[model samples]
Every structure is written in structure tokens, then in C-alpha cells.
Target chain A: MTAAVAEPGPTDAPLLRVRGLDKHFGPVQALYHVDLDLPSGKVTALCGDNGAGKSVLTKCIAGIYQPDHAEFLWEGHPAHIRSARDASRLGIETVYQDLALADNLDIVQNMFLGRERTSRGLLDEDSMERAAGETLASLRVTTVKSIRQPVASLSGGQRQSVAVAKAVMWNSKLVIMDEPTAALGVVQTKMVLDLIRRLRDRGLAVMVISHNLNDVFEVADRIAVMYLGRLVVQGDAATFDRQSVVEYMTTGAAGRPGGPRAKES
Target chain B: MAGALPERAPDLTAAPEAIAAELPPEVVAQSLGEYVRAYTARIRAGESGVLPVIVAMVAIMVVFEAISPNHVFLSPVNLVNLFQQSAVIMVLAMAEGFALVIGEIDLSVGFVGALGAAITVQLVQPLTTNWPWWAAILAGLFACAVFGAIQGTLVTRLRLPSFIVTLAGFLIANGLFLKVLLLGPFSGYPNLAGQSINLQVVYYLMWGSIDPVISWIGAAVVVIGLGLFMWLGDARRRSSGLVAPPVSLTLVKIGLIAVIAIVVVGICNTNRANLGTLEGVPWVIPIVLAVLGAWTVLLQRTTYGRYVYAIGGNPEATRRAGVNLAVVRTVAFTLCSFTAGVGMLLYASLLGGMSNNVQGGQYVLYAVAAAVIGGTSLFGGRGKPLHGILGGLVIGGIYNGMYLQGLSVEWEYIVTGLVLLAAVIIDSVSRRGSSSGSVTRV
Candidate 1:
């Protein structure tokens, strides 16, 4: 990890808050009263093993899957996200694991997509292309030679960047990415980590769900550990190391009464 | 957040630093030569464009010429015949192209075209209250569009398979064609036996021509207009820091188009007229050309076209993008049927009448075959209108060539079937290479 971790500044308010967020599938509970906070201009890493409810929490915020019960507060104002459209309307965007980009569309088309810039009766291609070029440049994503090349032709890392750019293209206040670097190589992963940091530096709240602890440690400022459908612990990233996260992920025993790190704390 | 600022904030307006300043930007075709090389590599890698069909067309010409007892393949009269025959199929193929590009099939296009012709005839003939020429044609076209919308709605709203919906549409339109043909003022003609009818205007679309001087002038304007647009558009793209094909390439394209246009017009200008010198290309040529040009612009330049390609490539993704897939998909079918109506006009003109025995099934098959043969994928997400021209030419060429050689109808069917199979095989194989194989990005 190159950058030091920091807690949310005292003056900063949480951009989004999830309290007692519970989701169940049939008889199984995917999330159990998970509480978390994402403040403006910081990165929160959501860590968990496969069934620890990371995806559920993300979907809840994204409005892809409604939580069975939860109080979702947006900028300290309670807001109900009933659909994906609602979440985006409230300036929340998610980059799904699959990216969900149209392979046949070029960068400009993919970026503007549902929100194309139309001048009069026709597509304002010049304006849209220029905007796309500027957006990529602002994000320092210059891997692609042309904004007109189809997303199908991009590398995994470049595709992830495009997805991230798409998430941030609108006036999104909070961006959640699910396993963005899972399909990338070493260099690509590094590129994405830099992009995440770039997003944070732009004063946007970012939440990343990642299995890659190295990447989480590299970019995440706040660490929230999930275990068995519950938020076991959360703190400044400095409070945990790779070993500690692994222990919490497996045993859910970070700082509970009489637990492993409780005595030391 | 202050501490997290990049050590060196990127100059957002400065020249973009590519991922690797050394290697080629992973996705651009930087120059004309590079574009060609990449294109060839893509073709070899099974991203089949119109290249294969083009080669096949040339081969068909050569083989037919070599095998024929006479110079029947390139005879100017036969060339004109080929163009006329191809017009209907080309229009139909263009119709199928819209649906196919969006990962759907309109099985009803052929019959829909037949019904259009039937309606046109019914409206124009004195057996009915004689409607004017343009009114009859417009009414026919409108009816066809509405019919298509019905099927499109059924498919999109009900989430029914387009193939099945349009298959039902095919049968319905087929029966409707007969009912339109056998009954009422359609073709009973006040007392004569039920017979086919063709309006002079309908017939003249294939048989008529502009004056030679006017044809030559129109040809010049069109060719020059296309060249200027390409040059200006490419230059505009370059100035905006976007990668455009090299000027040389644009010039070469213009040159090639000019050359092809010259040859075709020259052939038509020859004294192929059996009666007093019927010179100049058929009026239909220009109409077809205009249709192709307009469609190219629509597909390449419009938001609707973008949505079609996007839906074909990834329906879920397009939906996620907040696009109403139903509306886009439905409008696609309507547009397809509208084009099919245009093809029906051409067919009626060519056959000199709208006949009850209009082989609607066969027409739809040929339409799909032409689209696929021209390199539009049946698996979807990739295609162009230009492909209809190439594929229709090859299709019309085969039928004309075989007839010139005195081949029987059965042989035409056999060969058409074989050619269609070859095209589908190529599509499937190429798709696998591009989508599921080792060189995914290629």
C-alpha cells in the first residue's frame, strides 16, 4: 500500500449510510444488520469471503436488490432506493463485476449511452465524442487509441476503467465497484488502483468490494470487514493488516468482547 | 483527500499519454496501411467482413463466364437484367438486415412485400375506385408498416420469440395476399378472370430511365458529393484529435467508388436497346443508390442505429443503460417492414404484375441469405447496409448466370441452398473465433 489510511474527517458528513441492512434469499440470510458509512472523498473497502453478504449490500445500495429491511441514509437524509434507476438518480452508481458494457459500441457511445447528447433532431456526435475524450483524459485513461473503437477491443483493465468512467460520467456522488480488478493482470490491477485513487482525489465517495487484499490495502482508506452476513468490524485501514483481515473474514472475531483484537484495543 | 492528490496531477488538456507510449495504442488503426493490415488480419482471424462474399462474387463471375457456351455473364443486357432482379432481393435483404442486426428475424418480410404489391395493385386498378399512383403506393407502404408494427409489438410486449412471431406473420400475410388477390375489386377487373395487374408506373421503376444527359449529370453529382463528404468528415475527425483514416485512404475510397460508378453507367449507356437506343441506367439504380446511402447514414450516424447495434451486441447492457429495449426493437421491425414494402414495389415492377403466386416463403429465405452472405451475422451485433448490395449482387448473379447457362429451376434452388449453407457456416465459425477463442481482443 503506497498511501497512508485516514479516518473520515470530523467535519465531513457521511455521503451514504447503511444501518441494519438485511437481505435474505429463500431461507438463507445474505446480510444481517450490516452497518457502514461512506464519507465524501474517501474509499471504503468492503471485504468478505464468498457468502459473507458483500454482493447483497452492494446490490442494496445499487437498488438492484431491495434490502429485506434497512435504513439507507443519503447524505444524512433517509432515501429509499427502489430500483437501479432510483439509485443513479440519487447520484449512486455501481460498476458491476461484468462491466455490462455493449461490446459493439465505441467508447463515446458507451460512455454517454442512455444519456446521449442530442442537438435538435440528431445525435450531437462531435459534442459527445469530445466529452468522452475529455472524461477519459481527466481520469488519466489513455490506453485506448481512439474513443471510437468498440469496447470489445479493449483489454480487461481498460474495460474496467471505462466502466469506472461510465459510473462517474453522471453527477454521481457515490461509486461502488464490485471486484473491479478480479479479471486483470498485475499491471492492469495497478492501473485500476491508481484510477480508484484518482476517483477519491476528485472528492467522490468510493466503495470497493474486493477479494484482492493487496489491492484493498493499496487504495482503501477505510476498511469494513463482513463475516457471516454481518459487519464484524470497521475502522481506518491502519487498524488492520492482511493477517488481521483474513482472521476477521474467517472467524468474525476482530474486536468483539473477549475476541482476538478486543484485549489489545 | 488533500494528501491523496496525485504526486503529479495529469494535465487533462495535454496530449494524452497512452498506456504504453511504445506499443501501438491497443485499439487504433493509425494509418491507411495499418487499417488495411488490421482488416486483413481480422478477416483471417474469422471476423469475416464482406471480403469473403466479394471473393465469391468474383469467382462466380469467372466460373460462369468460363462455363457458359456464350458471353452471357457480362453482356450489357444481362447486366441490366441482373440489376433489376437484384433490386427486389436487395431491398428485402436490407429489410432483413435491420431485424438481423438487432438479433431478431422478420420471417414475414417476403410475404409482407407481396402483400404490399397486392395492395398497390388493388388500389390502382379500375376494378377498384381508381386511386392515383402515389396514393396507392403510399397506402400500401403504410399498411405494411402497421402490419409489421403488430408483429413487433407482439414480440416485444409479450416477450415472444421474434422468429415465432414473424413466422406467424408470414402465414397471415401469405393468406392475406391470397384474399387480397382472389376477392373483390383487387383483380376481378369488372368481369374478366382473376389475373395479375401491373401499373405502368410500377413497371417503369425497373424499365424506365432518366434521359442519358440527366443520368450522367446525376451520377456526377452523386459521386462527387460522396467524395466531398468523406474527405470533409475525415478531415474534421482528424482536427478534433480523433483518429481518422489517412487522406490517402479516403482519396482511394473516393477513386474506387468513382471507378465502379463509371463502369456501371458506361455499360448502361451502351446501345443495348432493342428499340430506338434505350440508353442510360434504369431509374431504379439511382433509387436503390439513394436508399443505400440514406440507410448507411441512418445506421452510422443516428442514435436509433446505435441502439440497434447495442441491443444486438448486448441486450441486457442496453437495457441497463436505461434504453427501452421494447421500443427500439419494435421500431426496428417497423422500419424493416417499411423497407420490405419498398422491395415489394420493385418486385411488382420487375415481374410486370402482382401475381398471387409470389413465392413469399422463398423471398424471405433469399432475403435472409443475402443479409448473411453479405456478412451480417445471424448471431447478431454486426452488419451494414452495404452488405445487402454485395450479397444481393451475388445472389442475383447466381440465378442469372444459371439461367444464362440454361440450368433448370431445381439447380437454382440447390445452388442457392448450398451458398446459404456456406454463408451460415462461415458466420458461425468466424463468431467462435472472435468471441470464444484465444485472441479475444483481435
Candidate 2:
């Protein structure tokens, strides 16, 4: 596959580094000593089967769940994300599968939901509309008929685009998407894959938790496969083919330790 | 990152014209014809807006005028009196709209409002405290707001359903209304026609009127101010290259407003009094307009209003956005009660007193009926203060026309119930249409 692999920068440190992450819910362990690195200008696809702890890891980074024992580094500095607000302050935004959008509100309203801008004690509709337009344009989202249209009137692809634009407009350095393309049709999936690439090109580190192998290989710069609540294999997309990813995702390993299917340094 | 997608560089820098072309024709509409076409398209797609209500109102008027004795239903005297009679229901509906917009209901507004008016009348009674009318009104509204806040707290803090909370509120306020009226110095209630200038002012709120010249000038000022506000705002947005309705459409809206104001002022100024004593617009018209204007701004142009709609539409989504849902919802109830106090004040003025005989239960039902019939969704998140006003007019029109025909009050209830059911059916059908293949915005 002709993956647009993002070249590593000269700096060795990554944008966000998670080390020895462990999470538990009551008696069941959801994640076990997982280490992950997300570099800027790259799309890292986290692939796994159901109950593989992909969602748990994404939630931990998003501050929705607190890992029992974990270390988080933001831009190579120690960072604590105890809540959603804390993660936002550190420039991390998450786009959940449900999108968390008010269907009755227009695009401009939804994009600025909690943090609406007001002037002279009223909503500055002109400024808000202009800003929303610019954000959508920057993302090359041209399918929407108008920025004032309510979100309920939008197609699945357009809604997904708006969700991404909402996340990217906040100057977030890292955006974690949970199954963005899971509900989209074929054409809509392509639209989202293009948008994902645009985010990477804009130098944002994106971690996508997806179960679709074709979507992951199409947009992801790096591949991380999870199995039985553990990170079984992670490396550049060039090092692992579709078969290797599937093998590691189900069996926890693909080949011998020294073989190319093993985790690459 | 720059070299990663060299082929996409030009696409990002595409010309503005190219981007503009990608938008729908309606977004870039440049002519009156195009604007009208777009609006018609929306109407066809089930965004009927207030059009259906207006049609219903017109139909009601025509049918009543054709059948009422001497066609008195459309006469200047009856029309002027109709507005005064409707003022109470209009304000109450506007009050209930606050809760309805936030996906909640306040069943206590009727008695809460009556209780508030009773407090005001009691305070201003010459045989009692003899307080200024303004102070009494303020004190009464404060009490109503406090009650609202309490009920709101029970709903928001304790996570109780607002229906049950406000239902309990209704019973408590009914009891309180009786108690408050007894507190007055009068045998059973308080009267407004007392020996005090402040009391006259309160009485004049519904029973009196401005001079003809002042009425004309006031109408002119209102029309011009509303027109200028709409035009200037839209013009500025257009100049800034933002999305705005076409200029012609804005002017058409202004023209419609001017026409409505003219008809109202013309009818009111025609000397409705058979004895040639009372004339011009009743003081209640301006009061009702003021209340309508304030609420329209509060619900349409403010962040707080947006959050109300958001919370009503999707509480989980709103909570995720970090909005304080409990505070917003509680405040909505407070405003709902505060506005209800104003409505009850008008009610007291209309009757010249507050007494235990007030039909608080019927008033509350009329409030809900007016709001719902005016096009507000009982399900919430999709209503306006204007709907409440129009709905109130329909209710008032039916009562006046039926009274002229010498029909009993039972017919009024039956007809209103039928109209309300029709409105709910229309609202649901339109909602379903808009949610599906319709092009109209939700």
C-alpha cells in the first residue's frame, strides 16, 4: 500500500508518550503496562478486536478515565490529565464515536458549543459564523451547503467533517478519534480518510481507534495492534502488512522476535 | 509536514470564488426573487414556521366575523377588548415558554402568578400598607422568582422530574393564593380602585390608554426602531462577507412589521368607546409588546438562550461541553416565574382586584394551550416567544367570538381542545418531515 508515511523529525522525543499504563475496572483489568508514542504529523492507528482495550487506552489519554498506574509526557514534559478540562489545557482533543453534537443547533453553534463567543452581552453571530467558515475551509470541507445549516440536516460524512473541524479549531496538538468511520458508508469513509490526512499534514498528532483494517491501512502512518488488553505489536506502517496486523491483533504476535513482524526499533 | 502532501498545497489555497461556488445557491442568494424562492422551498419542506398559526388565526377571524351577531367579532370595540383579555394568557404563555424551551414544564405559573398579584394588591391596599404600586410589583415578582428558584432547585439538584415538582408547586401556590388574598384588609380580597395615585397607575396598566397622538408616535417609534435594528444588523453581516439574508428579504420583513403595527394602531385609535370616552390603544398593548420583545431577545440573541436550547436538545452533549446544566435550568424556572408575575399583574389590573375567586387552574391550562397552539413543541428545544403571543391571540379570539354568539364557555373549551390537538399533530408531522428528507434546517 502507498501509505503517506510521515518522516520522523530530528528530535527523538515524541509529542505524547505513554509509559507503563495500567487501568482496571473493579476486578477486571482493561489495560496492562502499555507503552505508546504519538509523533506530530502522523496518524497512528490503534487496531484491535472487541474488548481489546483500545477504547480504554483512548479514554485514559482523553482524561475520561484515570489509569491506575501510568506516566504521561506531553511534548516530552511530564503532564497530568486528571479530567477532560486538564486534557484540553494540554491541547488534547477527543472526537468520540457519538460526536457529542447538538442536532438542533446549527454548525456555527455546535462548533462553539460550550465556549460560545459573546459581544456586548449578545452572541456575536457574524464573528462566530466567519470563524466557523474559515475552520471548515481550512480543512477542505466543501460538502456542506451552508455553515448555518443545522447538524441534523448534514450527511454522515459532513457531520464527521464538522466534528473533526470542531476538534482541530481548538489548536489541539493531539486529536484522538474513537471509531470515526465505523458508521460511515463507502464514500463517506473516503471523505473522512482524506480529512484524517489533512489533520496529519497540518502537523497534529492523531490517534485513531478503529476496527476496520482497510481504513487503518489507508490513513494511518503507524500501526499498533492490541490483544487481550496488551500492546502486542507497534511499528511504522511500512513494517507491517494487513496479514501481519491481523495476526498480531488476534494471536498477540506475528512471527519470531527478530523477524520483521516483531516490534521494530 | 509541508512536504508530506505537496500535491494538496494548491487545493488548500483555492480561490475564494471557487469555494463560494461550492456553497448552495440559497447561501449566496443576491436577489429578492431568489430569496423568496429559497424561503418557499423551506416552507414546502415542512419548516412551516408561524405560517400555519397565522393561517389558523385568519381562518378563525373570518369564520367568527361571518357568523357573529352584527359581525361584532371584527369591530373596533371587540378587537380592542380582545387584546386586553388576551394579554394575561399571552404573558403566561411566554412565561411557560421558558420551561418548555428547556424541555421542562411549569404547571404552577397560573397560581404562582395569581399569588404574586394578590401580594401586590394586598401591599398597595389603602386600608393596609398603602405601599407604592411599583414597590408592590417588585416585591410580588421577587416572591414569585424565589418560589420558582425553589421548585427549580428541587428539579435540578435532586434530579426530580420537573412535571411532578411543578405539579406540587401548582397545588401549593393555589393554597398560597387563597392565604395571600385573605391577608388583604378587604373582607375577602384586595381591590385596585383605591384612593391612591399609585393604585391608579396599576389600574391603568390594562384599563387605560395613551392619547391618540401619543399612540401614533409610539407605534412609529417602535416600527422604526425594529426595522433599523434588523436592517443594520443584516447589512453589517453582508458587508463583512458573512452569511446574511438578502437585503430585499430584510426589507420585506420590515414592511410586514410596519403593516401589522399600522393595523393595530389604526384599529385601537378609532375610539372604541360607544360613549366617546375611551379611545386609542389600551395601555396593555405596549406592556404586552414590551414583554414579547424582551423575551424574544433573551431567547434568540444570547449565549444563555443557546445553552437552553442545547440542554433541551441533548443534555449529555451539553454536559460534555462543560455547561452548568443545573444552573441554566434553575435560572430558566426563575425567569419563568418572574415573567408569570408580570402576567398576573396584568390579570389583576384587568379585573381591578385580586380575590380567592380567580380561576387559577383554568388560567394555567390556557397558558399551556396558547403556547402549544402557537407552534411551540411540547417536546421542547424548538419554540419562540412569538409563538406564545400568537397562540394567546387565537385563544382570546375564540372566547370573544363565541361570547358574541352567546355560546357557553363549554364550547370554548371544546373548540380550544380541538385546535390544540390539531396543532400538536401538525408540529409532530413537520418535525418528522424536517428530520428526514426535508431540506429545512431543524
Best by lDDT: 2
Per-candidate TM vs. native? 0.89, 0.93
lDDT of 2 by residue, A32-89 (tens): 9999989899999999989999999998998989999999987766789899999987
**Residue range B1-442, candidate 1, lDDT tens digits:** 1111123433232233222121122244556776676676666666756778989999998998888777778878888889999988998999899999999999999988888877887777655646776888898898899998999999999999998999999999999877877756445322212332335676678888778778788889989998998899788877765656777778889999999989888888887877888888898998788778888878877888888999998898888888999999999899899899999888877876677778889989999999999989897788899888888998999999999889998999999989999999999887775554111532
Give the top-scoring candidate (DockQ). Answer: 2
| Residues B1-442 of candidate 2: C-alpha lDDT, one tens digit per residue | 1101112222222333333333333464668887656556666666666878899899989999999988888999999989999999999999999999888999999999988988888888777798898998999999999999999999999999999999999999999889888774577767888569778888999998899899999999999999999999889877777777788788888999999999999999897766847788889999999999998998889989999999877788889888999999999999999999999999999999887888888988889889988988887787889988999999999888888899999999999889888888888877776666312333
Q: Give the TM-score of candidate 1.
A: 0.89
Interface RMSD, every prediction, one decimal place: 8.4, 8.1
- Clash pairs, candidate 2, are none
lDDT of each: 0.81, 0.85
Q: Cα lDDT of model 1 overall?
A: 0.81
